[model samples]
Structures are given as structure tokens and as C-alpha cells.
Target: MVVSLKESDFFSKNRRALAKWISAVEDRLPEGLEFLQRHYHRVGHAFRIGITGPPGGGKSTLINALLRVFRARYPEETIAVVAVDPSSHLSGGALLGDRIRMDAIGLDEGIFMRSMASRGSLGGVSEATADICDLLDIYGFDRIFIETVGIGQLELDIISLAHTNLLVLSPECGDEIQAIKSGIVELVDIFVVNKADRQGAGRMVNDLEYMLGLRVYSGEDWRPAVVSCVATGGSGEGADGVFELVEKVESHRSWLQARGRWGRKNRRNLERKLRQNLFHYLQREFDFLQPLLEQKAEEVEKKRLSFSEALEILLEEFSRQFSSSLKKRKGG
Candidate 1:
């Protein structure tokens, strides 16, 4: 018997249950799929911020620090963090230990953290991360933080999902000309030069400022700010102050524009997932017809069956199956 999400007496309203519901959606669970179409709008209220930088740039430390800062400020609200680490090619599982490093925060009642394996997805961690965020939103988390796996060009993927994108770099990243570029430098809403105590950091900041000065921005929103800091020692006393500046600039109009972009991206992502799932379902439906595709040289190989004819036969086969199932249900 096929599982049905809506018809069954299930407690999908619970937080953990909702999370499980999202996992079901990830696998294209027919039972849980109906709820998503009707309730998706109700599940999106949190302010999403994406954190991304090159590996070894202290991204985890920065995220840890932000959690502390945000938690202290909002005593009544819960925060949800989604950390993504790419799967190891050899093992096909993630070696993600953001959970290990973030143990202290998870102990709190107000924080919920999850780690996702990239699963070879280049754009989003899983094709389901966005949907997973929607699940968390329905559970009542107000601030959503997504930390991207610091793989090459993957930073772009993370920023696209967030309202405010912070590009974390170091003072030594670029030489005199700031040669070593951050992956998503152009899209940065805030540029952080972490580990400022090191040499050449000062020059790095200057080079970034030089580049920013040449940029043209006619929008009322201020140009992206570059802040320098040491994530380890609480360096750059002013570094913590930059976040408020980011918030002030992100008005509803700005947010709507960002969501419009996200909406288009979501459409593309959904289409891709639908096509993949459709192909999988089709393969199972046509298992008995596999021999037709693998027909041997002597008999049907010489017949040279046209592609159009094969499609026609497959359509008829599925139509028959569907019609038969409907008739059987009606008879009962």
C-alpha cells in the first residue's frame, strides 16, 4: 500500500515531525508531497543570512561567534543553523564536523542546528536544503543561518539563498593589489578581513577600499562595508558592530528584490528535481519493457524501430496501467 501524508492521522505539526516531513519530501514521498503545495507560504518568515568563505578562513569560528551574539540579543527567539559540508568523493558521505565544533551552542534550548552533506550538488547543499529551511520556518525559528561548504565557486550558491551575504576573507588574502580574491567578492554585502593581527592585513584592507571607491551605486542602500577582525581573539572591536549596519540597510523593499531572485532560482531548482523524479518513476514503470530498448541485432535490430514509435508504445503502456488502476479502485 502507498503511504498517504494527508489521509493518514499523522502529527506533522510537531517540530521533529516537520523535520521528518521535509526528509520525506526530499525523497519525493507521495504521502507528504500534497502538504507542501498548500502550506509552503506559511513556512517562510525567518530572516535568512548565508555565511561563506574559502576553507581555513575561520568561517566556523565566525559562525560560532555570530550565534553567541544573536542568541544574547534575542532571549525569547530560537535560531536555526544549517551547516553544509560536501560529500567525500571516495566515501559518498560527508565528513562534516561543524556539529562537533558547535557543541556548546546546541546544548541551549533556543538553538537548533543541523548538518547536511552536499551530496555532489553544486548549487545547493542538497536539492532539499531550501525545502528543509521551509520546514524549520514552520517550526517557528526566526533567524536562519546557512553556512556553505567552502568548495570552489560554491559560495555563490549559498549567497543566493540568503538575504544578506557576508564574504569573509583575511588581510593577507590579497597582496599589494589584494591578489588573492574572495570567491564571492562582487556580491558581498559585508566584507570581513579576519585575522587582522597578521602582517599585510592593513594593506589588504586598503586595496579592497580602493576597489570599492571605484564602484558605482545609485541605490539609497549604502555600499557594502569592509570590516577587519580576528575571529579567534575577538579582535577588531568594531567588527561586531557591522551586523547592525547590515540590518538597517535591508528594508522590505530590498528584501522583496532579493526574494524575487530567490523565487526564480527556486523555480529552476524545482523543475530540475521534478524532471529527475519523473525519470526515476518512469524507469520503474517501464521495467518490463527494458528488453525492447536492448533488442538484439538479428531480429528487431534490422527492424530499426523509430524513437517516435518507441515513445508511442511506452505512452500506451502507461495509459493502460493508469486506466486499469482507476477501474479497479472504482469497482471496490
Candidate 2:
């Protein structure tokens, strides 16, 4: 049986209820949209940070280190993490669940961690990621971290949802200039070089600094800072440069807030979210035109009609049906 949850349950910070609602949203169920609508007013309180990079870039370890720093700095504040993992083809579940990697952090009462499967999203994030972030914000978490699966050229969906986007890199991923060119470098607010203890770390930093120097940013004078860190806290050595990384992130946040860009960014994010939701709704309702669409496809296959011509016919039929439905409603 599908579990039902009330809005009050979410407002009260009930983990079980929150988890169920997130699942519903991930599955694109109507109840989830309803819940989001009910609690829409409570969002925008938490600061969202998106961490993304190539596989083996140590994003998970970096996040784990940052979590420790956040807890120590703000002991009383709540923190939430949404880790996106590749989906398992057989089970359709998160392949690398949060509990397996960040078990220690999950044990903390002040920290809430949930893993979501990318489920074939090319951008290294799930479609429901922004919605889940909103729910966490409404739950009163002071900070929200969205860690995406391994990133590539088109993996820039995080830019639309996060206030600050961190592009993680590693020394072993040699030729930093070539690496940045392959990803969406312009959208990043900060660059983090994890595994700083490895060789070529300094060279990587220099390459990134040189590339960033060529960009001409408008309005504000905030330049993306490159910070080095070994995230594992290995034998009292892994925590190196972590404090600097955290400081740079906080500094960017303050810079955005000072110039009134924070609110503007949030508005832009809302617009993108609304557009995505509308597209999803239209896709869900496509069944109303599916039979006609199939017929149109067959016509195209037989060369009886061009693809564009068939599409036009399909749209005309859809418009007629939509008009009839509206007329019937008015008469009723």
C-alpha cells in the first residue's frame, strides 16, 4: 500500500514522512506535487550548494569533510545532503546509496542524508532534485548539499538549482585546461581540487588560475577561487586546505548576498523549476494524443507524409480535442 502523509508531518520534521514524500516526487506522483504546493511558502531558507565533477574526483569525500566542518562551525544548525547516484538497471535503485559511503555522517541527528538514482538523466542529477531541495529547505535545514553523479559536458543542470556550484577536480586528471574546456566552466562559482596531496596539484591550480584570469565577469568582481584539499582526513593529513575550501564557499555566498544577487538567483531558479514542472505535466498528459501520434509515425515511415507535416496534423487534431473538451466543460 502507498503510504499517505499529511503536510503537518513534513512541517514537524518527520524523517519517515519526508522520505516517502521525496519518493513520491521522484516517481512523479500527483500527491508529491500537492505536498510541494502546500509547503511552497516555507522554502528559500536554506543555502544550496551543488558539488559535481568527473568520476573519482572525490566529490563524496569532499562533501564528507565539508559536513564535518559545518557541524563543528554551526553545532546547533541542521544540514541535509542529497547524493545522486547512477541507477541500477536491474533494481532501478541508487547504485551507491548514501549510507554505504557516508555512514558516520548519517549517524548524526543534526544531519540528514538521502541518496537518489539518476535514473537515466544525462545531467548527472535526477529531475526531482530541485523539489527535494525545496522540501529540505522547508524542513529548516541551514544548508543543503546536492552531490551529483560524475559530470561531463552536458552535466550542468545543477547550475539551475544551486546558489553556489563547485566544480571538483583532482591532480590525477591531468591537463586542467583540457578538463575545464570539456565541462561548463563558466557556470562554476568555485573550483575545488581534491586529493591535493597528490603530484601535479600545484600545476593544476596554476592552470585553472590562468584560465579564469581570461574571463570578463559583469557587475560583481567575484572571481572563482581554486582551493586545494585532501578530503579523507588521512592520518591527520587529509584535512589539509579544507578550511580554505569552506571559507571560499562562504565568501562567495556573502558576496552574492551583499550585491543582492542572491535573491535574483533564487528567482531565476524558480522560473527554471516552474518550466520543468510544466514540461513534465505536458509529457504526462501526452497519452491523450498518443494514438494519433502513433498513426502519424506510421504515415511518416511509409513516406506518405513528412515528419513536420505529420506533426502539424497531430497538433491540429490535439487542438480540436482540447477545444471540444473545453466546450463540454462549459456546457456541463
- For candidate 2, the 10 contiguous residues with the lowest summed lDDT are 174-183
| Pairs of residues clashing in candidate 1 | 5-31, 174-178, 174-179
Q: Candidate 1: which stretches are off by over 4 Å? A: 1-15, 152-154, 175-186, 234-332
- Top model by TM-score, which number? 2
lDDT of 1 by residue, 242-300 (tens): 34433432543264465474465445545655665466466666676566445532234
**Model 1 weakest lDDT span, ten residues long:** 3-12
Model 1 error, position 175 (Å):
6.9
Instruction: Assess the local accuracy of residue 332 in candidate 2 as a C-alpha lDDT between 0 and 100.
Output: 50
Model 2: how far residue 121 lies from native, Å: 1.4
In candidate 2, what are the lDDT values of residues 1-332, reduced to their tens digit? 86886778877888888888888888878899787888789888899999988877888888888888888887998889999889999887898876467644856889989999888777778788888888788879999999888854325778878999998888877654485662466788888888888999899998888888778877666778899888886323347888888899999999989999899999998888788767765665566898889888999999999999999998888778767766885895
The residue pairs that clash in candidate 2, if any, are none
TM-scores, one per candidate: 0.66, 0.86
User: Could you give me the TM-score of model 2 versus the true structure?
Assistant: 0.86
The CA lDDT of each predicted structure is 0.64, 0.82
What TM-score does structure 1 among the candidates reach? 0.66
